[model samples]
Target: MTNHPHASSDAANALAALAAAPAAELEHILSEVCSSPAWAAAVAAARPWSDRQALLAANRAAMAGLTVADLNDAMAGHARIGKPKAGDATSEREQAGIQGVDTALLDELHEANAAYEAKFGHVFLICATGRTAATMLAALRERFPHDAATEAEIVRGELRKINDIRLGRLLGDTA
Candidate 1:
């Protein structure tokens, strides 16, 4: 990705550039933020955000309105909770807590992930930033009983949290 002049700028300035960027460029940037094409397009079209908070609010709203198909599309971008691969530094860092656990724990996580995928028909999605591998496994197990509709809603919420974190990073807001 070419560093657009505003990519490293402050939140307000970056968002201002995002609003005015060419459609393809804006879509590319927003896709990195969230995988759902509809979500990205909606957010890009609703640009000119007043501040970081407004951008986050729009993200929340866009995510909240996602359909099950959109949610599934977005979830496809995530690695299974404890099994992040070498690619995608953002995912690796978000799931850093799971990086160096015992083999037994990693095996258990793999098994739980398989089970979760079997039950939900999608990878277990969560805001794994700051969460332990055990916690992620527990969450997968806990959510296993939810019906498909319920699980989809939970996934949407998790996706929203992820989008917020990624958006903050995009805008160079450490907090």
Candidate 2:
């Protein structure tokens, strides 16, 4: 990111490059990098990264404080169920991640998602990494009965957890 040998310049440039992106581009990048409320600020403040590890670490740290709204926005960038892209096949993780949802589970999740939206006026959000179809389906069923405020917070937490695992793999960096 930086031309000079100094770590400061590169870190600064990486962060600046991210910050200067147009709002939509920034949002897409943030969603691609990690979906969390703290995404914008963390990516925005990624200056002075010592390396890829530090950049990802800062992202994790910032995501620790993400609000529900942030998680939802990040999810908006994802391909919805029954709408898989060929590129999703490019990432084995995505394959494994998506494979966790079986047809039956997908059907139930769809119904649950619609019900969740009807009840809460938002998407039925989750961080689907490493989750099995039954487990995800159960989770959707379990969470479906919750009231709006409680469910909103739960979805946010799930998004954060999912984001952490995603970034950890993406950059080979852990928080």
Residue-wise C-alpha lDDT for candidate 1, range 1-175, written one tens digit per residue: 1355665455566777777889999899999888899899778867778877888888988998888888888998888877786788888999998978988998999998998898888999999989999898888889989999888888889999999989888777553
Q: lDDT of each structure?
A: 0.85, 0.60
Global fold similarity of model 1 (TM-score): 0.91
User: How badly does each model clash, as a count of residue pairs?
Assistant: 0, 0
- Alpha-carbon error at 10 in model 2, in Å? 17
Report how far off residue 111 is in candidate 2 (Å): 1.6
Candidate 2: TM-score? Answer: 0.62
- What is the number of residue pairs that collide in model 2? 0
Clashing pairs in 1: none
Best by TM-score: 1
Residue 30 shift from truth in candidate 2, angstroms = 3.6
lDDT of 1: 0.85
Lowest-scoring 10 consecutive residues by lDDT in candidate 1? 1-10
Q: Which stretches of candidate 2 lie over 4 Å from their true place?
A: 1-29, 35-38, 49-57, 64-68, 81-86, 89-92, 95-103, 173-175
Clashing residue pairs, candidate 2?
none
